[model samples]
Structures are given as structure tokens and as C-alpha cells.
Target: MNNRYSSNSAGVFTWFRDAAEQGNAYAQFNLALLYKRGKGVQRDDKVAFVWMREAAKQGIAFAQNHLGAMYYNGTGTPPDDSEAVYWFRKSAKQGDASAQQNLGLMYRKGRGVPQSDEMALTWFCRAAEQGVASAQSLLGEAYAQGLGTKRNFPLALAWFRKAALQGDATAQLNLGLMYRRGHGVLQSDTQAVAWYRQAAAQGLAAAQRHLGVAYAEGRGVQVDLERACSWLRRAADQGDVDAQFNMGVMLSNGYGTRKDEAQAFAWYHRAAAAGHMLAQYNLGGMYAHGRGVQRDPAQALVWYRKAADQGAPNAQFNVGVIYANGHGVPKDEARAVAWYRHAAEQGDASAQNNLGVMYANGQGVPQDDAEAVRWYRRAAEQGHPLAQYNLGGMYASGRGVERDPVLSYMWISLAAEAGDETACNNRKLIERKLTREEIGSAQALTRRWRDAHRA
Candidate 1:
């Protein structure tokens, strides 16, 4: 219920005071509203509470609802959940839709009553049936998630449509998602875009970000990088981390805008501060390569470690490189080995190759040709040119298994095709040791391997 009151007529305050003195409930409620808003009266929560209490005691449903809100929020009196619940229950039983919705929220959150999805659903149904838009939205969500009811996509769609038609931003967003995912509706990018536009116009940040991505990817609309940037900026201004990251990428790559590395760095830093893993990794790159800031190995390591701690394989590999190369820290081959192992276990080919080199040289691990061959094979299967060359050398020298010239030739030839200069030179030397028929067999094996592993 709106509590705004105007003292436009002359002597209105005096008239209200006289009526309230004579026990007029409307006059008391109106006077309380005026006092609460400081309209032609001194703002005094205590006075407002006293007058509101008098009106509520006289069975004024609106006043009782307001009293409950005031108690719940500690606006006029100390917060008392029980008292708020009592007033809300009284007003709700009298068909006050707002009170009923509020009571439902309280039950859903267990604020003043035991948490009961059934009670929440019952109250929400009552308010929704009375055409309360927010209650309709909540009821739709409950149906969609099967909270206190069977999951019913059709009912959810119906309730969401009702609330969306009433201009509820959240309902519009949810409706857009349903259309996009084909939940209880035919998948239609056009329909999703329409609903997203409604919520985006209402200043919903998530809707703005989703619309930006749709425009960028040409999913629900024609590709429009300028429009995508505009929408992304709007969401980024509202502190949306994904939007901030996207903005950084667009600015850095000069996508539909002039390249602004400094601005991109700022956006990336903002997202990184919010704990975005990719943002942290990119921030480390910027520091390491001096992309938009001065090169600082120490800062690079700091950001890389942050991303690494979050299980970023690339960051872990970079961390290993940094320690192995002694960039802004003491060189520690053992620490490098540990970091490389972490990334290699996650299937990072570069880390696998590096681990193979470490094992072969016995820098941070026991000198074991078998362990080196194991790591090299893992990386080679993933098409790592360096690991293929290393594995070929191991086979030629019989360092791990018995020397096999045909296998060595095939592996080195594969590495040479990948533009490894060392492998190309090594392949020419190994060719002199093989017969013509052996070379033909190795060439055929290479073709079969390439076809089988094509990705």
C-alpha cells in the first residue's frame, strides 16, 4: 500500500490532528504516513510508530501491513520478527496481497517461521492468483525448480509469461533463458532476443551481459561488435565480472573499436581482483610481456601464482617456467619439477615435454631413461614436436627400450613435419642407417599414425 500523503489543502494538518484525537483510524494512519515522510510534519519514527499502532489496533489492514514492514526492517521500533509475523499474518488474512507475498518470503527464508517450501508455495499461490507480479515470478521459479511442487515446465512458462507481461525484469530474463534453452517451448533465438531486450531495457545487468554475448556471437542477432561492446560496458559498469573480462578482450583485440591496451589492462585488473581465473592469467601475461604495463617479473609471478592456485594448467606451466628460469626468484629445478608435474597431470603437452627434459637430464629427478621415455611418449601422442624429437632420440640410442631404427625414423619424421629444425637434421642422419624397404615401412607407419590421431 502506498503511504504517500499530501497536505495540499490549508489546515490539513490541523484537521488530521483533530480527527486523530477523536480516534479516527484513517486520520491516524494518514498522520503517521505524513510524519514518516516528514511531509508537513517533523520526521519522527517513534511518533509514526505510535500513530500506526493506533490505526493497526483498529483493524486497518493497510496500516497493519505497514506496521509489519516497519517492525521487520526496524524502521520505527527495534526489529522483532515475531511481531512482524503477527502483523503480516493479520493483514494477509484480510486479503492484502503485498502482506501475503512478504509472509511467503519470510517462510521461504525461515525469517520468522520454520522454513517450509509448502507454506511458501501456498502464500505465493494466493498472492499470484491475486495478480501480484513478483509473487507470480516467485511461483514460476518454484514450479521450474520443483520446490514444494512437481517440476512443471508448462506451468512455469505460463507463470513466467504472466509476470513478464507485467514488466517484471527477472521474469523477462528467465523467460528469455527458457526460450533460448527450449524449455517447455521451441528453441528460438529470435524469441530469446526479444525477451532479453525487455529485461536489458529494465537495466538488468545479467540480461545486458547475455545480450552482449549474443550480439558478439551472432547467436540471437546479427554480429554487431559495436553493439556488443556497448552492452558489455553497461554490465561491466555494474560490476559484472564476465562482462568486464569480455570488455577487456574486445578492447585488447581492437574488435569493433580502436585498440586500447591500457583500458584493456584496467578492465582485466578489475576482473582479476574479483577472482576471475582467466582474468588473473591474462593479467599475469600482461605483466610478463609488458602488454599494457611495465614489465615486472615479480608482478607476473604474483598473478601467475594466483591463477595457478585456482588450478589453471597454463598458469601452472608458466609458474614452472618462471622458477626454472629464475625470473624474479632463485632458480629451483625441484620446484619447477613439482609445478610441471601438476600441469602435466592435467594433460598439458608443454608441461609433459618439459618434465621429460628434466627427467632425461636428471636436473630435478633421478636419472632414469625409462621415466624420460614415459613423459616424452605422453607429450608426443598429443603432437608435441619437441617431445617427438626427444622420443625419437631415445629410441635411436636405445636409452629406454631396445634401439629400433624404424620407430626412430617414423617419430623423427613426424617431428620434422611439424617444423622442428633439430628433428629435420636428425632425420637425415638416421636415414643413412636404414635400408630402402625399412624406410618405406616407416613412412607407411607415419601415415597410419597421422590418420588415427587426426584431431
Candidate 2:
């Protein structure tokens, strides 16, 4: 389209310049647009500003609006918010929808005048009424968020629908969100997907990502891994961070495509570089395991620490393990305990179990049998088998709580049933110390507990 305009620019410029020199406001505005776009001459904002100012002085509303934009952006002159507002107000008062929308934005952001939602809404309403799709979308946002008036879901829905029908991608995306959340319309995954598809068809990256997730999760559509991967790939190519990370996961797991660890690593690296915590954690694992890249404990530690700093419990646990084992750094029991505690406090069962062992052995903190029992119990109740067996041992030895042969038998029996060989051996030893009746009672207790925790 630009090429078409440039091709005939010389003839068009001569015609417009002749009329503009004869004081034709329309010709002046046309010439200004041509100069601004470099249609016939080298792009010159100064010349564009001169012609636009002349046309605006002759009361051409569009020229007035253009002049305001030039002032607001410092395109041809020093940026002056006050001057921009002056021209916008002049054109807006003359019933120019674009000018009204621009004025509303200036007021909304406190760019040229005092921030005033009420005034912004007033101008937005004017432009929206005049069928300006951008203004309609902004009006919908105002109503939805209670920016200038009471929150009105119905009004917001109505305005969003108006703009969306005019092919406004943002409005379509917002409308989909409203349906998905049941804000102004009935909650309908199908309707949400329909609106999302509309926006996605227009190349909206966010909409594409949402649509891909919906397909992957079988929300509003049949589960279609291939379709999900296709959509996600599109959004990832556009640099959508979430899509990039998800694409990495899909590639790594062979979902909808052949497993390609190298490609997965590339995708993860891209997202991790963009500060995605999960990507950083996953990249750390890949590096540590030598999957798709050479094993590099230093690189693994770098990524793990990055994610751990963002409060990722799994990353914290990995960092603790690394510090404790001297992987890529000197062994530091104190640092290991600190990282373990950070994750354990966040309800990570594995971290709780590890912290229990650390306490029991006096690795970093002084040995405290009772503290070990407490952490072991926390992880055991969450179905950590190792913690359950450790708790059983604690009970059998009376290390933390009162020694109870039956309780030890029951817990050890449960852990043994979960395929822990050590627990099985311990259970046999505990059984030998119990009376027949006590052994039967322990068996019944294990049954009751398992039934209660059945998935």
C-alpha cells in the first residue's frame, strides 16, 4: 500500500502543492500527510508540521488533530503537552471523533491537564457515540474498571461487543475474558474460545497463547495436542514468554511432536533469559542432567540460584542439594540448611524430609531429635514415604516422642506397603517385639489410615 502511494507521489505532490499554495485547506492537509509519509519528498516532519499548522489555522479538524499529535510527540517541534491539549480541545469541540479520543487519552493520563476520569469519560463517550472503535473499547474498559462511573458489566459488555464487531482485536480479547470469567455474560468456555479465535485470527499473540492453552487443557474444545503445539509455536515465534516456556515443555515431553531435547533446551534458554522462573528451573535441570547440552554444574547452579531467588520451592530445594553436595561450589552445610528451610516452610514435602534428616544428623544445626520428629511428621502426613519410615524409627527408639511399639509397627507397616525395603525390614523387627493382639491392632490401624487417605 505504501509502495502504491510512493509510485505516483511526484504527480500527486505537484497537484496538492499548487492547490495548497492557493490557500486550499484540504490541499494543505493532503500535502502535509504526503510530506509526513515521504510520499513524494524525503520524509520531513518540519514541512508536515508547517502545512498541518496552516490547515489547522483554517479550521480543518483533522489537520488540527494532526498538529496536536506533532506537538504531543515532538515530531516537528519541541513537545508541549499544553499546546497539544489546546489543539485537541479545539478539534474535539468541533465534533471530531479522533480528536475527542486523543483528548480523552491526554486527560486520562494527566498528560496535558489535571488527571480527571470524569472528563476523560465525557470525551470517550462522545467519540464512542460517533462510532470510533478505539473510543468504544476505552469506554468499555472505563465502565468495567469503574474508572469514571460505577462499574457496569452490562454496559462494558455492550461497548466491547460494539468494538469487537468492528474488528478491534483488543476488544475481542477483553470480550473473551469477560465470557470466560462470567463477568457480564454467562460463563461459556465455548463462547470464550470463539472470541479468542477471532482475536487470534488477527494475529494477537496473547489470544493465540490462550487459545493454545485451551486446546491443550481440553477447555472449550477437544484435547488436540497437535493444534495446541501449532498455536503455541506461533505465539512463541512472536516472543510470547509463556508460550515459549510451554513450547519447551511440549517439545521436551514429546507432546504433539517428536521429543527434541535440543530444541526444548533452546526454547527454555530463551524464556529463562527473559526472566521466567520456571524456565530457569527447568534449564537448570537440563544442564545438571546433561540433556540436550553438555553437563555443566556451574551453569546449573547459575540457573537454579536465579530461580531460587524468585522463591521457587523446587529450585530452592535443588540449590540446597547443590550446596550440601559441593556441586559447582564448596560444600556449605549452613547454606544448605537455610535453603532447605526456605522451601520446607513453603510446604515442600521433599524439602521437609531433607531438613528432618539434616536436623537428625546435626549436619548444619545441632542435632535435635524432637525437631527432626516434627519435620518428619509434616512430610509424612503429606505422603512422603521416606519421612514416614524415618518417623517410625523415631517412634521405635523414643528419640522424640514416647516409644510406642504399636505406633512404630503401624507407621513402619505403612511405609513397607509403599515398597520401602528398609521399612519392610524394620516392620518385621517391630512385629517380633509386639504381642499377637498388638500386632493385630497395628494392622487394623494401617488399614484405617490407608482408607482415609485413599485417592
Best by lDDT: 2
lDDT (CA) per prediction: 0.92, 0.93
What does candidate 1's lDDT look like per residue over 1-455, in tens digits? Answer: 23233435325666787899899999999888877887776789989999999999999999999999999999889998888989999999999999999888888888888898888999999999999999999999999889888988899999999999999999998899889999899999889989999999999998999999889999889999999999999999999999999999999999868899999999999999999999999999999999999999999999999999999999999999999999988999999999999999999999999999999999788888998999999999999999999999999999986899999999999999999999999999999989999999999999998999997
lDDT of each residue in 1-455, candidate 2, tens digit only: 35665668888899899999999999999999989988887899999999999999999999999999999999988999999999999999999999999999999999989999999999999999999998999999999999989999999999999999999988998898889889888999998899999999999988998899989999889999999999999999999999999999999999988999999999999999999999999999999999989999999999999999999999999999999999999999999999999999999999999999999999989999999999999998887889989989998999989998888888888889899999998888888889999999999988998998888
Per-residue lDDT value at 144 in model 2: 92
Question: Please, what is the TM-score per model?
Answer: 0.84, 0.87
Range of the 10 consecutive residues with the lowest summed lDDT in candidate 2: 1-10
- Name the top TM-score candidate: 2
**Clashes in model 2: which pairs?**
none
Q: What is the lDDT of candidate 1?
A: 0.92
Candidate 2 RMSD to the real structure: 3.3
